[model samples]
Target: MFFTRKAFPVQFNEHLPLNTLIENIVFTVFDTETTGFQVASTDRLIEVAAVTVKGCQVQSSDTFRLYVNPERQISQEITELTTITNEQVAGAPFALEAIEQFFDFVQRNETSCLVGHYVAFDVLVLKNELKRSKFHLKKLQHIDTLDLIGFLAPSFDMRDLEKYAQAFGTRIYPRHQALGDALTTAYLFVELLGHLKDRGYSTWGDLLQVTNSPARHLSF
Candidate 1:
């Protein structure tokens, strides 16, 4: 499928009030499945999904999921790992169109922040897709659940998403598939926020300190 290039509305993450309570922020917890991890050159995005969270709750009715046609063959190893066969994405929209829709969903959800398991990688995946179409990701206000976990439990070292979910006792969904992982991550994100609140980090600024801290960086 071909998509004509068009401008997408800015996410405006910097405009949100830092004084707002963390619970009051609307977070769009999202995940992506890609052709591979080398997003800058060869790997392309295959699927993206997101769930909304407000007041530390997953808003079930507000969700987004899309499979993207990568215009390339799906490697057998990836299909085995993700269960996303080439046939599944044959009729799907291409990366640019699918991403535009994803951005539209974010706008419609009134998201104040974006959350993900390993958010920097996912952000890079999206940026590469946009760059392919001569578009730029101007700014993204995002939080990594991975970083939050580091800040909250510096002694805990497991970096796998399901392991962290199991350790935190959050809901576990089917692994690898975009929406299922997104749902799992969303629940885990909320749980992490609860722990942060217990430590008196209850405001947007406070949460930012934890996520933005250089010490919170995890190798995973």
Candidate 2:
């Protein structure tokens, strides 16, 4: 299926710290289970979800979830995993365009920051995509729950997604869909927040240095 590219405006935001943002800023619990791991050539985002949070509370009304037409064919394995076939997204809006629109929406409508599991991957893919589309990442403070999970539970040996679902006691619904995974990620993050608070740290800065993924420093 052929897709027509739509032009979108780029936004540059001030450096709003996530710790400070968490108190007053809303939280967009964001996640993307993409078509593939790589963000460059052969890989593109197939689905994306953002759950809105105010004062750390999830608000269903202020959420965004979409299945994007990647403007290309999803592989057999990916299609089976996500249950999103080429035909399903053939006429849908492009993924990049959807993200651009989502960015504008979030920047304008919500007073939130972003939270994601293995968030560096999301950030990396987003920055790379923006660069490809000639956009800037004014760079808001983003919280990475993968790092949080590890920092919070250092002894926990987690190698798979099921492990997280088991450890956090959060249900992983809908398997490969973006919103389902994001919702689970949000639940896991909330659990992590409780862990941090129990440890006498209520601010993000107190945990930022210790909660970053080891690979995140390599690129993010």
Candidate 3:
């Protein structure tokens, strides 16, 4: 069943004040494995994963991951990168079904901040897929770890998640998979939150204000 934009009401919890402590805030860290880079063109999502964090800790039981049948052939290069072959997704649910489950998972924590590394790309792909499926996600507040890392370490290469993880002394095993990346980002986010706290960013608003500063010019 396709859900129209108005099918689900925007829950009131999403408006929770941002003045609360950062460690106390709930966060939903997610990642997507897509067919290609361009969301406006032919790219499609093949996999997605989300993990919940609260009190600066990852909740393993609250994780969600799914393989999506893109309804198109998986490219050889993509297969090489993600190790998600065409055969693996042959019986998987299509984008519409998979996204529905994803939405359900997210709605469980309507007020949680959405998080990812290079998050804009993942969010764009998800939004585009929802549009194509005739569904709409409730507007979400997002935190991009890439932007945070860029602000903190201007000289380091911010595009590579592995590099950032290494700098933080975090390990991202089985990299490139959706779940693995999400877990890695969650760890990096926790570490970044510590640095932000040390720099007087105790509230969600404080962190957002700093990351959105004009001087940073963070693209992610």
Candidate 4:
């Protein structure tokens, strides 16, 4: 279905690690779940969710969620992990349609850059599909949360979300929903942003350098 276009609220980015380009800034935090991890072979994306975050707040009204019909059946093993079954997605909208909508929503509302935990892998999956569709999905400015958290809390222990959540005094919820994970990541990202501001990391480039590599931990 060809969408006619709709206006969405502006997302946020002025406070990000970027320099002085503050006008028309926004950011989109997104996540997706598929039949499996490998986007290259048989696995395909089944669900995708995203939210616009501005001023360190998730705009609940400006969220997107969709389930797509995976041409192949989802394995029971994968289903157990994500709680998504092949029947749930059967006859749903096509992958192209869901992605097209997500692409447009993000392009219209998003700024700054796309971000998420383990964002690199997710970006790879979307980029590959967008390339195949010849869609105009932006190769985000790139922010891998695992790297960011490492940079800020060099002394903080535990890399997994469960451990991190305990460190932050919150319980991980909904386990594996895309939107649920995105919400959790959003909270963590804002905390990192605050930490950066406190430490004087005031440019996008400055923040990006640390996150571009693996998270570094301090000994002792």
Q: Please report, as a residue range, the 10-residue window in candidate 2 with the lowest summed lDDT.
A: 5-14
User: Any runs in candidate 2 off by more than 4 Å, and if so which?
Assistant: 1-23, 109-112, 212-220
Tens digit of lDDT per residue, candidate 1, span 112-181? Answer: 7788987778888887888788776655678889889989998888889999999999999989989999
Ordering by TM-score: 1, 3, 2, 4
In model 3, what lDDT does residue 96 have?
Answer: 76
Ranking by lDDT: 1, 3, 2, 4
Writing each residue's lDDT as its tens digit, candidate 2 over 140-201 gives 65677767777878787674555687787866766667787777777677767767778877
- The per-model lDDT (C-alpha) reads 0.85, 0.68, 0.79, 0.67
TM-score of each model, paired residue for residue: 0.91, 0.81, 0.87, 0.78
Q: Which window of 10 residues has the lowest lDDT sum in candidate 3? A: 211-220
Instruction: Tell me the tens digit of each residue's lDDT in model 3 across 1-220.
Output: 8444533233324455679788778788889998888766788999999898889887867899999998899999999999999999889998878877886787787536788888888878877887786656555667788778877777887588898899999757578899999999988988888888887789877877766733222121
Best lDDT among the predictions, by candidate number: 1
Task: Point out where model 3 deviates above 4 Å.
Answer: 1-12, 213-220
**What global local distance difference test value does model 2 have?**
0.68
In model 3, the Cα lDDT at residue 44 comes to: 90
* 47: Cα error in model 4, Å: 0.8
Lowest-sum lDDT 10-residue window in model 1? 211-220
